[model samples]
Target: MGRLRHPGRYRDERRPERACRGRADRLLALLSGLAPYVDARFSLLCHSYGSVVCAHAAPLLAQTGVQVSDIVNLASPGLDVSTVGELGTSARVWVAQAASDRIGWVPNVRVFGVGHGRDPLDPAFGARAVDVDDAQGHDGYLVAGTSSVRRLTAIAVGTGDAHSVLAAR
Candidate 1:
């Protein structure tokens, strides 16, 4: 539900797995609707549960010919998948979790299909990791004046990688 050019927020405190699935469907539709207006592939920047929506929609987007160049997840508990291969997309996947963020303690497990899967930052999850040790907290990834924002911007624009991008500047 996120486009790199624009960012938005969603609130769903009473979250449930069933509701998330519905949101993923809607997100898929919205992206599909906007695909025609884009001159290039989509780069999704998602945080928290929004990462779950992106993860669910990514493979569907691929099947429907929506070219997604990158997906960057911030403070994500899980993407509902144990590994990148389970995501079923060719887009480069990135995950950033601040060291002080408490979400790291959340177990990436599915109890009767009601939980997010493996922690996205887990080494076995296979996403390009973004170092956000300087971020203030879980919600600070996109906050202006943070180092993570700079690295994230570079990745989204496809001009750089996580480590070398800012150094080249």
Candidate 2:
């Protein structure tokens, strides 16, 4: 349920390919040792650029016999979702976005020859959409006592009422 580290050239200068490769490499190491040390019902909770890493890593991990229970992307840019082809079919995917999110609002067209635009809100993306009230920017997904927090906690524990998950938060 923790975030994965992805190494790259520079935090602000990385190409998508570099990011994906770093994530794929790191996840391979994690999947290789999973059987003896991790839970069978593991899930992925990704945010911002981390979601892109998870997207790249999921299929590779599946090929190694690691099963994911869920893959939640809080504020992700589009990935090669189509190219990867059903990477999270075995996992319950929850994609949440705030209407006011500043970064997400950036038009999901190609940018600087690197496309960082995948609107999980788009019907074609195939993720269950959740709304996060007042989640207006990059760092708001982890806001204490918010819908994002509730959804993330639910995925972490494996079972919870999604219907009312974010009510108290």
lDDT of each: 0.75, 0.65
Alpha-carbon deviation at 111 in model 1, angstroms: 2.1
Clashes of each: 0, 1
> Cα deviation of 132 in candidate 1 (Å)?
1.2
On lDDT, the leading prediction is 1
Clashing residue pairs for model 2: 78-118
Candidate 2 differs from the real structure by a C-alpha RMSD in angstroms, to one decimal, of 4.0
Q: After superposition, how far is residue 5 of candidate 1 from its true place, in Å?
A: 19
* TM per candidate: 0.83, 0.76
Query: What TM-score does structure 2 among the candidates reach?
Result: 0.76
Question: Which lDDT tens digits does candidate 1 get at residues 1-169?
Answer: 3432111233443455545667778878887777678757778888777788778787887755567889988878788888999988899998888878888888888887567878877778888887666787767887788777878888888875645432211
Best by TM-score: 1
> How big is the positional error of residue 58 in model 1, measured in Å on the Cα after superposition?
1.3
RMSD each, Å: 4.7, 4.0
